[model samples]
Target: MYSWQNNEYEADGVTPKLSEAKRGPADPRLTQSNEDQLNVLLGAVVNYDKVIGDHTFNILAGVNRETIRNDNFSAFRRFFISNDIDYMFAGGDAEKDNGGAAWERARLNYFGRANYNYKGKYIAELLWRVDGSYMFPKDTRYGFFPGAMLGWVVSEEDFWKDNVPFVNYFKIRASYGQMGNDNVYYNDELQEYQYFSTYGFGTYIINDAMVKSLMESRVPNKFITWEVANNYNLGFDFQFMDGKFNAEIDLFKNSRESILWQRNASIPQSTGMSLPAENIGKVDNSGFDVSLGYRETFGELGFNVAINGGYAKNKIIFWDEAPGAPEWQKSTGRAINAGLYYNYAGVFRDQAEIDANTIDYSDITGNLRPGDMKYEDYDGDGKITPNDRVRRDMNNVPTFQGGINFGFNYKNFDLAILFQGATGAEQRVGTDESGAIGNFLLDFYENRWTLDNPSSEYPRITDRSDQYYSNNNTYWLRSSNYLRLKNVELGYNFSTTWLEKTGISSARIFLSGQNLLTWSKNKVLDPESSNALGHYYPQARIINSGIMVSF
Candidate 1:
C-alpha cells in the first residue's frame, strides 16, 4: 500500500481568469491519493520421467491463474479564508474537476512441455501454451503459442575422441516460438478508452443559458486483439582442452506484427472526423549474442578470462501513412532512429567569396552574408531549396556493443577487471538540440570562426542566420565510439589456519571501483547514452572497500 499528498501555491500574474490550469492560493488546494493492490495466484504442476533402452523421456504440465486490481482518487477546493484549512470541507467553493479511477485485470494460462533424447547424442523438445487476457473482448480473448527445439551433441560420438583428443565437447541447438503482448500502448498499459468509446462534457451557450453537453472524446474499436512476435534462434556450444576453454554463440531474428498505433495522427483531415487505434504497424528486429571463457593454472596462480560482445539492429517495415508525402518523406524500411537533414559544405569567410559562389542566395537566405553556413547543392540545380536537401539514415545508434572481462587468482588473493564499449554509432550536436547559450560546453567557443580567425570548421556566433547554425545536417553528426574501464575489483580471502582463534567461520576483504575511466572523441555527453540535451546525469564514479565475515 502507498499514499501521496500534494500542496502548492501559484502566484496570479499572467491569466485573465483563474481555473484548474492556473490555480491560485484562493484555490487553497490539497490533493491526496491512496493506492493498493492485491494479487492471488493458484497453480498446479505434474512431471514424469522415464528411461527406455537408450532413450530418455522428460515431460511437464502446468496451469496457472492470477487476479489484480488498483484504485486511486483525489479532490481539490477553493476560496478558503485561512490557507491552514486546505481540505474540501473547510473551503467556500466546490472543485469543478475532481475525480478518480479504478481498474481490474486478470489472466489465465495453461502450458505443457516434453523432452526426449537418444544416447545423449540427439535431443528434441516441444512446448505449447494457451493464454487468456481480460484486455480483449470475450469473443476473441484467448491465444495459442507453440515452440520447438532440437539439438545434436557431436562430441558424444566416439569418432571425435580418436580423431580430436584436444576437443572435449560440441553441441548445436535451434528454437522457434511466438509470443503475445496484451499491452495495447507501446509505453503504457491498456486503458479504458482503448477498449471502448470514451466521453466528456462540452460546455456551450444556448439561448443565453450555459449548458453542458455530452461529447465523445475517443473512438472505439472492439475488434482489436493481440500484437504478436515471432522469433527464431540458433546457437552452438563447444569446449576445448578438457574444459580449460569454452565458448557459446547464438543468433536470433524476430518480427513483431500487428503492432498497436493510434491511426488518428495519419488520417486525412478532409474526412472531418477523428479516428481511433488499430493494428496497423510492424517492426523487424534481429541480432546476435555470444560469449567465450578460458581457465588455466600456472604454479600456484590461476587465470580465468572471458570476452563477449553482440549487436542488434531494427527497422520499421510497415506503417500507415497518407498518400501525398514525397517518397523521401516516408522513413519506412530504415532504422527506427534514422533522420534526414540539409548537407553542410563549409563556412563562408568573406563577402567576395559569398558573392562569387554559384548558389542562389535568394533561394535560401534572402539576406545571405559571409560567416553563414554553406550548404551543398545536392540536387545540382543551382538553387538551394528544400528539395536540394537529402535523406540519410545511419550512425544514430551503435549496432555493435561488447565487453572484455578477465580475472587472476594467486593463493588467497584475486583481481578482476572489465573493459567494455560500442562502435558504429553517431549523433547530432548544437545548442538547438543538446542545449544552448549557458549550457554550451566550455570548448564550444574556443575554435568557432570569427573575423580574425576565419575558420572553415565553425560559423560565427550569431542569431541572425537561422539557416546556418540552427539547421540540422551531416556536420552535426558526431561519432559515438568509446572505450571505458567499466569495473575493477581486488580481494583476498583469509586462511582458516591464520584465524584459528577468531571464532569466525570465514572472512575476506575487497576493494572495487566502477566507471573509473573513459576514452572517446565525443564531448557533448557520455557516448553510450547519447545525452544531447544534458538531460541525463553523467555516469557516476563509484569506489568502495568492505570486509565480509560469516559465523
Candidate 2:
C-alpha cells in the first residue's frame, strides 16, 4: 500500500488602494486575495495463484483513490470597472468572501494469465486485463480493456523436420484489445467566475420622476464532455538463418470519435462570449509498418544492419454544420491540414500585351507592374477571381522518410556510421516586400528594379505599392522538401579480460556528433527546421566525447 499528499498557495496585494473620499461604503473591492489547493492519493495491489496438473494460472487486482480541494478568499472589498463605470459591486470580505470546492474518485483493475505445455513440442499461453478510470460521468466512467494472444513454434512440429535443414526457429502470433482515455480538463462542469462589467449611474439620491438603466450579462457552458478513441492492429514476426536475420510487419487503423472541439458559432454579444467546447467531430487514421534486422560474422570481422519505416494517411470523418460559417464551408471534406499560396507570375511585357491577354493588371498590389507575374483566368469568364486560384503540387505530409545504420568490428577497434533523411514537404516563406523600394529595410532592396537589374525577380517599387503588393494566395508559399544528416558516432569497447584483471566488470570510451551535415535545395536559413511557416529558429550542430565504466 502507498499514500501521498500535496498542497499549494498563492497571494497578491499590489493594486493601489482607493481614497476614502472616492470609495463607496457598500463596495466590495478586494484589496487582498488568496487561493489554495490540496490533493491526496492512496493505492494498493493484491495477487493470487492456482495450479492444476502441469499448468498454472495467476490473478492480480489493484485499487486507487484520490481527493482534491480548492479554497479562495478576498481579505478586503472588491470592485470591477466596466464601460468606464463602477456598475456592479458586491459587499463581502473575510468570511463572506470565501469559496471552496472539493472532488473525490476511486478506480480498480483486474488481470489474469495462464501458461501450459503439452507433449514438450507445443506450448501455449493466454492473457487478459480490465482497467477503469473515474474521470467520466459516474454512469460512463468505467470501461473494460481486454487483450489476448496465441503463439506457436513450427520448428517443434514434425512437418518440416527433413526438408528444411537450415531453418532453426519459427512462430506465429496475434492479439486484439481496446483502450480509453479519461483526460478531460478539471472543473469542466463548473461555470466559474469571470471578470467584466458595464457602465452605470453613480450612487446618488434622485427624484421619483427620474429614470436610470443598467446592463447585465451571464457566462455560458456550465459543463463539458470527454473524447474517446478506438484502434485495431494486426501483424506477424519471422526469424531464420540461426536468428541472424529477422523482420516484422504490422498494419493498423484508428478512429477518434466524439473529439472535443471549440464550436465556431458566435455567442450572444450581450453575454460577451464567443466559443464553447463540444464533443462533435471524428478523425480516422490508417497505416502500415515494417522493420528488418541482420547480423553476420566473417572471421575476425563482424557486420550489423537495421532498417525501419512506416507510412500513414489521416482524414476527417465528420463535422456538424458550423453556425455563422460562410457558404464556401462544407462538411465531410478532407480537413485543411495545410495550405500553400499560388506562385506569382511576372507582369505583362507591355500594355499591348496586357490588353492582348484580356486581363486587368490595375488591381494588383505591392511593387507590381506591367511586367510582373502572369495570371491565368481559370474560370475563362474574362475576369480574375478566386476561381482562378490553383492548388500546389505537394501535400503537407512527407511522402518518404527512413534511416540506415552500419557497423563493423575488427580486433580491439570499431567503426560506425548512421544516416537518416526526409523528403517531399513544403513550407511558406516570410519575406518583406512592403516598404518603399529604395528606403525600406528589406533584403531584396539591394537588388531592386534598375536598368542594370531590369530583369530582377522581385517587383519594382512605386507609389501604387498597395495595388501591386497585396497579400494574396500567390505571395506566401514555398516548398520545404529536404534531406539531412541526423547524427554520427564511433566507439570502441575494451576486452572484458583486461577489465577483469583490475576487478572491474567493464570499461569503454567513445566520441559522437549530431546534426553534423545536411543536403537540400531549400533557400532559407535552414529549410529542414521550422516551428511553423514564417517563424523559424535555427539549430546548431554539436559534438561531444565520453567514457563508460561498470564495477
Candidate 3:
C-alpha cells in the first residue's frame, strides 16, 4: 500500500482602512506541508482438513513480513511583497523555516494453528507464533509465543437438549495467550533501533565564529528487549427464551513483564549522560466484562435493550525505587500514573488553632492564617516537607466504564438512544480567586470560608498571584464520574408502495444528536477530560438531519 498527503495554508493580515497608521505591518505568511507513506506486506499460507470416523482435524501455517516507510516535509515564510499575491515566492527571504524527517520500520512473523473436534460437541485448539522486530539487539530481536483454547457446546449435546429445551444455546470456553511489545519511547519521542548509539551535528560558537560540532545524541543499551504479556481468559455465552435473551461474561488476568522504562531512580542525573531505557518493570491487571441483552416483538412494534460494562484494576508488581525512599512514596504496588499529594486535613477555623498547632508548615504555605488549608504530616515529623506527600489513586484513568443502548422499530419508524458513563476517576478544579479571569463561580463564592460563613469545605479567597493556598491535595480532587446522553436518532422509512410510486428502491430521513446532555458532580469542567487540571476543550454537541434515497 502507498499513500500521500499535502496541506497548504496562506494568510494575509488585514488592516482597517481608517486604522492603518495605528497597526503595524500585515506580516503575510504561507505554509506548505506534505507527507508520504509506503507499506508492504508479504504472506503465504497452507491449510489441511480431514474427517476420520467421529473425529475431525484442521491444521494451518503461515509466514508474514511487513515494512513501512514514512516521510514528512514542511516549509513556512512571512513578509510578502504584496498581500494581493499569496505565493511563497512573493515573500522576503528572512524568517524562512523548513523541516523534514523520514523513518522506516519492519516486522516479520511465523505462525501456525491446529484444531480437533469430537462429534461436534467438544473442541480444542493450539496456536504458536514467532515475532521478530528491529527495535532490539540481534540476539533478542525475536520472541516466541504460544496459546491454547478448549470449549464445550452444551446445546449440541443430546442430554442438554432433553433436560432444558427452553435454554436454546450455551457455550463455555477458556484460553491462554502470550504477546510481545517493542513500542517504547524516551523524552516523548519514539526510540527506534534503541540498541545502537546515535549522534547529531549542531552549531556552536568558537573563536568568535560559528562552528559545526558532532556530538553523541543517544547512548545505547544492548540488553534492552521486548516486553511480554501473559494473558488468561475464561468466558461463557448463553441464550434463552428462543433467542430473546442473551448474555456474555468474561474474566481476564494479564501479567506484563520486562516493561521498557528508564532507570531514573537507580541512576543519578549527575552521571551527565542520557541513559537508554531498560526492560525491568512489571505489572498485573485483572478484570471482568459482562453484557446482557433482550429483544421482543409485539404485533408491529419491535424493540431491543442492551447493556454492557467492564471493570479493570492494575498494580505495579515491580519498579525501581529510589534508595531509602519512604514506603508511602513508592510507586510499586500502586496503580499506574498515581500521583503523590499532601493529605488534606481541613482548613484552620481560627487563629487560635494555628497557634496551638506544633507541625511546621512555614516551608510550604509561607505562614498559617485563619481559613487557610491544612495538611497532614505523613512522616509524623514536626515539619511538613515533600517527604510528607503520599501516593494517591485519584487520576483520570477510570476503573469502571459502561454504556446502555436502546432501540425500537414501529412499522416504518425507528428510534435509537445510547447512554454512556464512567466512574472511579478524578480531576482537580482550577479557580482564579482574585477575579482576574472573571468573577468566581456562585457556588464557590457563596460557600467560601469567611468570618461570617466559616465554611470548612472551601478556603478564603486570595490574590491569584499569591501561591499561598496552592497545594496539591485531596481538597482539590473531585470525582470525575459522569453519565451522558451519547447519541440519539430517529428515522422514518417510506413504505414499498410509496417508494415504487416515486420510482425509488428505498427512501428514508433521519434526525440525530450526539453528546446532548451530561450529569456530573464536577460542575466546573467536563469530567471526561484527562488533564489533572481540567483545562482542555470540552466535547462538542451536535444535531444533524438528513435524507437518503436510492434509485
Candidate 4:
C-alpha cells in the first residue's frame, strides 16, 4: 500500500480586524503554509493447513516493510496595502520570513508461526520474529524474539463429559513471549535517530554582524538500541449452564529492560555539556483481567450483560540514582515518574498549639501562626526543610479499570447501555497561586480554615506569596476515582413484512447519548483530565437521533 497527502492554507489577518483584536491595531498580514506527506507499506503472507485422522497441522509466515516521509514550508509577510489584496506578493518583503523542514524513516520485519493439535483436545504453538529499526546503528539494529504456548481442553474428554453434565466447555492455556520496542519519546516529543550527533540552526552576533550558523544540539551514542520486554501469561476460559454463562480470567507479568534515558540525576551540571542517552533502566509489572457474561431469552425478549475489569501495577527495578541520595528521595523501588511532596500533617488550629510544638518550621515560614498548614518532619530532623520531602506512589494513570455493557431486545425494539469506572490514581486539583489568580474551588472556600471554623482539611485564606500556600504538599492531592455513564442507545427496527412493500430490505431509527453523567470526588474538574490545573477542556456530553436504511 502507498499513500500521499497534501495540505495548503492561506489567511488574511486584516479581514477580521473590524472588531478590536488582542494586540491593538492590526498590521494587515498575509500567511501561507504547504505540507506534503508520503507513506508506503509492503508485506506478504503464506498459510498452510492439513488434517489427517485426529492430528492437525497449521503453518504461517510473513514479512513486512514500512517507510514514511514528510515535508512542510510556511511563509508570512506584514504591512499589506489592503485586505482586498491578501496575497503574499502584495505585502512588503522587509518584514517577511520563511521556513521549511523534511524528515524520513523506514523499518523492516520477518516473522513466522506453526501450530499442532491432537483430536482438538490438546494444542501447542511456536513463533519467532526479527525486527530492524532505522534509529539505531547498523550493527545493533536487528533484534530476535521468540515465543511458545500450550493448552488443554479437559471438557472434551469422554470421562469429564460424563461426570460434568451441567458444564459445557472449559479450556486452560499458558504462554510466554518476548518483544522489542523501537519507538521512543522524551518530554512528549518523538526522538529520531538518537544514535547520531545532531546540529540545529541558530543565529549569532559575530563581530557585531548577525550571521546564521549551525550549533551542536546532541551527543552521539553508538550503542543505543531497541528496548526489550519479556511477558508471561496464564489464563482460562469456561462456559456453563448450557452456554448461558461464560467467563475468562488471565494473570500476566512483564519485565522490561534497556529503557532509554539520560542519567541527569547522576551527572553533574558543572560538566557544561549535553550527555548522550543510554539504555540502563529496568521495570516490572504484574496484572490480572477478568470478564463475565450472561445471556438469556424469555419468549420474544432477550438480553445480555457483560462485565470486564483489569488491575495492573508496576515498580522501577533499576534506574540512575545519585550517589549518597536519601532513600525517601530515590526513584528506584517506586512507581515510574513518582512525585515528591511534603507530607501534610494538619492545619494549625490555634496559636497556643503552634507555640507548644517542638519541630522548628522557621525554615519554611518565618511567621508561623494559626490557620496555617503544617508538615511532618519525615527525616526525624528538628526542622522542616527540603530533606523532609517524601515520595508518593500515585499519578494520573489508573491502576484499576473496568466497564459494564448491557443490551436487550424485545420484539422489534432494542436498548443498550454502557458504564465505565477507574480507581487507584490521584491528581493535584487545587490552585497553585491563590488570591492573585483565584481560590482553588468553591467548596474549598466554604470550608476554609478560620478562627471560628478551624477546619483541619483546609488552610486559611492566603495569597500567592504566602509560604504555607506555595509548598508542594499532599494537601493538594485528590483521588481521581470516578464512574461514568459512557453511552446509551435505543432503537426500533422495521418489520420484514412492512419493509417488503416499500422495496427496502431493512430499516431502523435510533437515539443515542454520550458522556451523560459522572460521579467523582473532584467536582471542580473532570477526574480523567491529566491537566487538573484547568488548562484542558472537559469532556463534552452529546445527544442525537438518526435513521438507517438498506435497499
Which candidate comes out best when scored by TM-score?
1
RMSD of each: 6.8, 12.2, 7.4, 7.8
- TM-score on alpha carbons, each prediction: 0.84, 0.65, 0.81, 0.83
Error of 1 at 202 (Å): 3.4
Angstrom error at residue 206, model 3: 5.3
Backbone clashes (count) for model 1: 2
Q: Give one digit per residue, the lDDT tens place, for model 1 in 456-502.
A: 66876643224544646677677889999999999999999877788
Give, for candidate 1, the lowest lDDT window spanning 10 residues.
1-10
Tell me the spans in candidate 2 whose CA falls farther than 4 Å from its real position: 1-35, 49-58, 70-156, 160-167, 182-225, 263-275, 320-336, 340-400, 432-480, 492-511, 525-528, 533-537, 545-551
Model 4 TM-score, all chains together:
0.83
Q: Write the per-residue lDDT of candidate 2 for residues 1-551, one digit (tens) a residue.
A: 22222222224444333333443555434445567777777777677776667555556566666666666655443454433443224433333343334344445555555555544434555555454554444454455655555556666677765667466766565555555554533246532211122233423336855345553432233343345566666676767798898888877777777665544443444555544445667887778778888999999999999887777766678765546443333334453354424347655554465456656544443233454556665546665555455545444566456777777888766767777766666655434434543244243356445544654255554332444333444543445566566667777788998888998897778888887887766554466554333345565788978888899
Prediction 2 TM-score vs. true:
0.65
Going through the candidates in the order shown, the clash numbers are 2, 23, 0, 0
Where does candidate 4 clash, by residue pair?
none
Best by lDDT: 4
Q: Is candidate 2 or candidate 4 better by TM-score?
A: 4
lDDT tens digits, residues 46-161, model 4? 99999988999999999999999999999998888777898988888786999999999889999999999998899999999999989889998999999999999989988989
Model 3 ranges off by over 4 Å: 1-40, 47-57, 67-104, 117-120, 200-210, 215-219, 298-301, 349-353, 369-371, 409-415, 431-454, 461-468, 489-513, 533-537, 540-551
Rank by lDDT (best first) = 4, 3, 1, 2
How high is the lDDT of residue 284 in model 1? 91
Candidate 3 lDDT over residue span 115-182, tens digit each: 99998779999999999998888899999999999999989989999999999989999999998999
